[model samples]
Structure formats: C-alpha cells, structure tokens
Target: MSEQAGSPLEDLTAGGPAIDAFELLANETRLAILVTLWESYRPFAEDTTLQFSELRERVGTADSGQFNYHLDRLTDHFVDATDDGYRLSDAGLTVVRSVIAGTGIEERTLEPTTVDMDCKLCGSPAEIAYEDGWVYVFCTECDGLWTDRSDDERGQLARFSLHPAALADRTPEEIYAAAWLTTYQKLHSMIEGVCPTCSGPIERSVVVCEDHEDDGICGNCGRNGRGAARLSCAVCKEWVQSTLGSIAKYHPAVVGFCYRHGLELQYGVESLAQIERRLDEATSKVDLVSETPPRVDVTTEMDGDEIRVRLAEDLTVLEVSERTA
Candidate 1:
C-alpha cells in the first residue's frame, strides 16, 4: 500500500499534499460524480455500483471524452473502479456528505426574533437568530453576540425557538435551568468522547474557575460559580464547561448508573440529591494528601464494574479505569 493509504489522518496532515486533493475536487463534473456514487451507496445495501454509462447519464455531460478525463482525476483518491462499476471511496463519501450538509446550512434561512433578556451591559432588548448553522443571541444595544452551535440541526432550531414565553408558566430560575439542561446535553455528548461541532475527539479536564475567589464565577459565561469542569475538542479546540456538580454527569460511570436506574440526569430536587449522594460516596473512597492543588485518589464500584479515578484540584477526572473482575 502507498503511504497515503497507510493512515486516514495522512490525507489531511501537514506532511501530506492536501492542496492536490482539494484541487482535484475543484471541478463540477468531479463533484457530481462523487455525489452520484454516494447516493447509490444506500444504507443497508450490499452493492453500491453504477455502470460507467449510468454514471455518465446521471452527471448529464454530453462528451464522453471529457467525462472520462474528469472521472480519471478522482479515480485513485476519491473514486474506485471495479469489475462491476464505480463507487465512491471512503474519503469521497466524507467530502461529499460534508459538502451537502454545508450547502444545506448555507441555503437555509432563519427568521430572527427578539428574546426576553435585557443586555447586561446596556439593559436593552436582545435578539436570537440562526445563521450558517449556529444559533446566536445578540444584544442590539451593546452589540454583544453569544453564539452556540448545537450537536444536531434539529437542536439548533429548538434552541432558537426557546423563547422565555415558550415556557411562560415557568419561573425565571426554571427557565435558566431549562436552558442549562440543553447546554448540558450537548456537553454530555462532547465529553462522552465525541465533539458535537466537528465529530472530533474531546479532552476533559478540571480547572479552577477564574472567579473561584469570587465564589466560582465562570470566566467563559461570567456566571458566578465555584469551579468548572472543562471539556475541549482535541481537533477543533471548541471548549465547553459547567459547574463541578453539573460536569460530574459527563462521567461515563455516572452516565451508566443513571441509565441503569431509569433516572434522567437533570437538575431537580431528587436528581441533585441522588447525584450528590453518589458523589459523596465516591469521595469517601478517596484519600487526600494535598490541599493547595487538591488531588484525590478514589474508587467506585457500580453495576458489576469497578472504577478508579484520580481527580485534580479542580475536580477534573485526570485518569480513570474500569475493571470487570
């Protein structure tokens, strides 16, 4: 196998000539071919083949010679030819799917609406809007934009429609709690090993909130808190955080236990108490020897599994392990 075929990451690495790959895809005919092949590869299907004549007809090009030339360009990198016919390579499928999704987001229009929040800086009305697949809350008076991108397209729309009046009967704290819950769901998905933004690997750590001295203010959101558990995408560096208590829900072991108990890990009287009890039990197993930069070595056993976790000063899970025995 060639060096390019040795590893998938090599295709886009700095060492690789990615510009050549991009240049090859910079043609309409080649893109059409990729799309055709991708569509033919149906879910749960055994075959993804399209005859050369069929592919030519689908692309709708008149000249066979020109079509062959364009097809040749993508042959080794994006397209594969077999005794049966032609199909998109793995890289081809990824590129075509990304292009289709991006085009959908760009072409889709969202109506802007005024939100109920007053600008913290100017005390004026704020507006919520969706653009380029991101949801934005902007203060018209202060021109402050707080942008959030959801894990999925549907969630993005739902977040934009979450007006204060939507939950008119709920209290202010309840509203904030609902919003926070949405944020936590996205955070949970990211910390569980997949980044919602780019589908990349995520790294979780515990950090002292800059406002730790002021009773745990989140430096990112300016919310008053004690400390935060931060999770950042390894590929995109998109970072998110929550209070230590909230972040604990991102733990795999905790999530598993919650799943087994038929418990929805949301912020509520019963849920919080359950989480606190579990955390306390996990904490009691730890032996702490340091205070300045707090460190704890702890173990927890749940659902026929044993987990050993080491925590940093800010309550980040520095290391974790599970044993079946």
Candidate 2:
C-alpha cells in the first residue's frame, strides 16, 4: 500500500532513533536526577518547578558540571528545561515511577503461614510466604511453587506491591490468586465507566485468539492458555488481560457456587478432570454482553437451583438472581 499524505505512519517512522531514549537513561546520574525531580514534584504540586541549586542540593551532588551534564542529557526527553529551573517531563515521571516500582522499594520477608489447600501431588498442606514483595504458595511435600522458576521476579513483585492493602491478612495462596482476580476485576471496572486504579475512563475489548496463537502457555504460572479479556485505562494507560474463568472467580455468584459445591477455585482445581466435569455440569452459560461497554453474565444451575449473575464491563457484580428450578 502507498503511504498517504500526512499519515500517522510518517510521525511514527520520523523518530531520530529508538535507542537514543535508552541511551539517555543508561547513566546513573541522569536516572537519579529524574527520581529526585519526581519525588520533589509529585502528589501535591507536580507542576511546581525547582531552581537548579535547589534540585542539585536535593540530589546531594557537589559538582555542578557533572550534574548539569546529566540534566542536559534528559532535556526534551525526560526532563523539561524552563526559566524557573527544572521539572520532570511527562515521560520523565513515567521513567522515575517505573524505576521506583521496579527497584526503589526495600525487600523483606513476611510471616509465613499454612493455607487451607493441599498439594495435588502429595496431598500435604500448602505453605504460603511473602518475600521481596512477591507472594509464594508452595507445597513442602512436593517442593512445588505456584510460579515458574524462570519468571521475571521484578515485574511480579512490582505488580503485587502496587496495591499493598490487598495483601493484608491474606495467605500467600489467597494473595496470589486475589492479585490476578482483583486486577482483573479492576480492569473490568475501568471498562464499565469506573477505574479502580485512577478513577479514569477505561476501554476494553475481546482479544482475537489468533493474535495470541504463539502464547500457548503462561510463562509465569505455567497455565496452558491465555485470557480473553483485554482492558486499557484511557488516562493511566494501565492494561490487563486474563481468562474469563480466572476473572469470574471473584463474582458473587461464582463464590456462592464454589461454597455450595465445596469446590476451591485455585490453581490445581482446573487441572483435575473430575473438578472440570463438576464445573461444566454446574455452569449453564457464560454469556458476554454485546454492547459498547460490554458485560459478562454467567449462569449456573444445579439440582433444581439456579443463579444468574450480571457483571459490569469491569466485572463488578451489577445484578445477581437466585431461583429454584
């Protein structure tokens, strides 16, 4: 196809070079400057600029030439140069926040506890622990951790620590499971006109299965498939994708169903053919509401009893009905 006049592709292909951005961030001093500006200007007066001397004092760098060199490198990319002095550019704040989330926090181990679930391989009690901000559920008898050994620990830890209150008073297994569910729920909520992350508008869509044909398994949990839902925050650009089943576990109707059937919604349950058979028998329909901001409605029926759940775009329970068949 021929390129059109003033096409968006022109702007996308007009960048000086992609590596130039990374090259700017390669220096320790430049990164420190961004972090320093981010800390001073955030949460209250992000638009507030700092004088060069004020910023330099906060950074604790005695050498003016060295600091200026680093600051100039960030200009027009991460740092915005102004007559008042300097402030973090939008891109600068993003880089600094990412760095803080990635490596700025201190690592510590939380108190370990035994959970209610047992190992699928050995039938022994499962143990849950938190270390370096990542929750771990493991079976001592089987030496099996819920996560894969080769996954990126940094990204995992960052995601968990994003919402610390969600982790409180929860076992490792619960935390691990809830982390995915809660984020899924929040992302769904964003799609439904409320954002749990930033109270911003959200956009959501069903991911084409063919687009992810190569992703046959999750590298982190070793789950055998990808999720269908894809949600993006219009303001924050936060995005999440997870299976309907995984996200649905948090629904009131699903929770009630699990309680009524004495079935636990955890990792190993789906792998068991008997449990899958039971779930299949109980679940009558998983319907996706076809609207601009879509909803997922799930129905379950068993032994003359039935429950219908209507979920908002963000997966929040909008309506739930229980009836006897």
Candidate 3:
C-alpha cells in the first residue's frame, strides 16, 4: 500500500529527530515551573502568563541563569513563551493535572465500610474501600464477584479507578458514588470505540471461558460470568475488561426498557443507589447461549417483558429479541 498524500505520517517525519519528552523533565526546576504556571493560569484573566522574574520568585529559585537554562529546555515542548511572559503549554498542563489527579504521587488507603447498596452476587450489604487509587467493593457473605485464584479466602465484587482528590471531605458513600460515575463514563466511552486514556481509537472483542464453572466466582475461569468484553487502545495500549452484561446497560434497548419501568439509567451522589438497584433489577439474567463461536445473551426485563441482546463472538449485536410474557 502507498502512503496517502498529506497524511498525518508527514507530520511525524517533519520533525528533524525523535525527541524524548521525558528526558527534558528530569530537573526539579522544570517541574516547579510547570506547576507554578498551572497555578497562576486563570482563564478569564487578561494576563494569565507570569513574567520571568515573577515566576522565578514563585518557584523560589535565586539563580536567574540556572532557572533560565531549565526553562529554555522546556520552552517549545512543555512551556509557551510569549513576549509578555510564559505560560504552560498543553503538555505542561497535562503533567501538572496528572499530578493533581494523584498519579504516582502518593499511596492512600481507606478502611472497609458498609455502603448503602447490597452486593449483586450475594444479597449481603456490600462493603466499600479505597486502596492505591482504586475503589473496591466486597460482599460480607458470598465469594463476591471475583476471587483471586491463588487465594480463595479474599475476593472483591468490583473495583474501579478513582483519584485520591475525590477522597477529601467525603463520606464512604460519596466516594463510592464518584468511582461508580467515573467507571460508567469511561466504560461508555470505550464501548463507543474511544480510548479513555489518550482519546485514540479502541479495538474491542469478546472472550469466552471454554471450561467455565460458576459457583459464585467460577473457580475454573476466575470470572463470575462465562463471557467478557476486552477493549484495547490501538494508540496507548490501555486495556479494559468487563463482563458483557455490564456494558449492556448502555444499549439503547436496555435504557428504553428501564425507563418504561419507571427507572432511569443515570447516576449522581443522590441517585447512585437507585441506579445501582435499577440496573441490577433490569439486567437480572445473563446466559451463554453458545461457546463454540462465543455467543452470549444479556437479558433485561421489565413488567414481565424481556429484551435479549444477543452478542456475537466479537461482541457485535447479532440480534435483539423481545419476548412478551
């Protein structure tokens, strides 16, 4: 195949040499400058940029030559220098915001506390906890959603990524709500063929456990269900895996079915509990109709009417059957 004229490939070749951006950020001064610019920027203000001397003072660097040397290293890539002053470039803001989001900054943990919702696997009240930038849920009674195959004693119903900033001045219930909302938004984006990390295109596929056994967590496959959808970003290589039934809630057929039953598929701190129960109630059945070609049916019910979403081996919608009871 020949390269198309004026392709994005041209832009990559235009740059003289491949530059390692991380190499320029090795010095503490450059990171401080980025953090300072991020702090000083105000969208509405006329002068969001900070003058060289003022920025140096804010960063507490006494030597002007040393500071300027570091600033010059980051100028074109991370910092934008205008006639008036300097401000963070798009890349600069990304670095600072990632730090603010608790990425690789520190490790924090929250002790287990009973949440308002009951476990979907077992009817026991679910307990929520936070550890290393993730919110985890576990059932007090059953094997939860998945148990570590190596250690049968420990298990978690679900775990979602959440930043440490969300933990401040919030109750355990509030934290769980934030995690749930974040997970829903990210998963929805991924399902629509978008990568949550880099905004790049995502590739999705379905995988079925051939030798599956479900006695709560499925000792053979280590999956609560037989089939799961796996998504990978073509650009960033970020991977996300979830049971096919969980992603079915985003289907228009399921949403419409739940709305007809007086349940809205939505989420907020106040509505998180309601949405959890409503989704669980509507999607009460998941059956693996075939294992050879890897087909699964995620069924949602309302007022005795059932909508079965049949997914193919790659998780594409093969058929949607509505059965009236």
Best by lDDT: 3
Clashes of 2: 3
TM-score of each model, in listed order: 0.54, 0.49, 0.87
State the lDDT of candidate 2 residue by residue for 171-290, as single tens digits: 555565655455545655754666675677777654322222224334443433322555677887767655555455556566677667665544343232434344445544566565
Instruction: Give the per-residue lDDT of model 3 (tens digit) for 30-125.
Output: 889998999998877888999999999999999999999999998999899999999998878877887888854455678988978887765788
**Model 1, residue 249: C-alpha shift (Å):** 0.8
Candidate 1, pairs of clashing residues: 216-225, 216-226, 217-225
- Which candidate has the top score in TM-score? 3
Two-way TM-score contest, 1 vs 3, winner:
3
Q: Each model's C-alpha lDDT?
A: 0.59, 0.60, 0.79
Clashes per model (N, Cα, C within 3 A): 3, 3, 0
lDDT at position 19, candidate 2: 60
**Over 4 Å off in model 1, which ranges?**
1-15, 112-129, 136-201, 211-221, 235-243, 256-262, 266-325
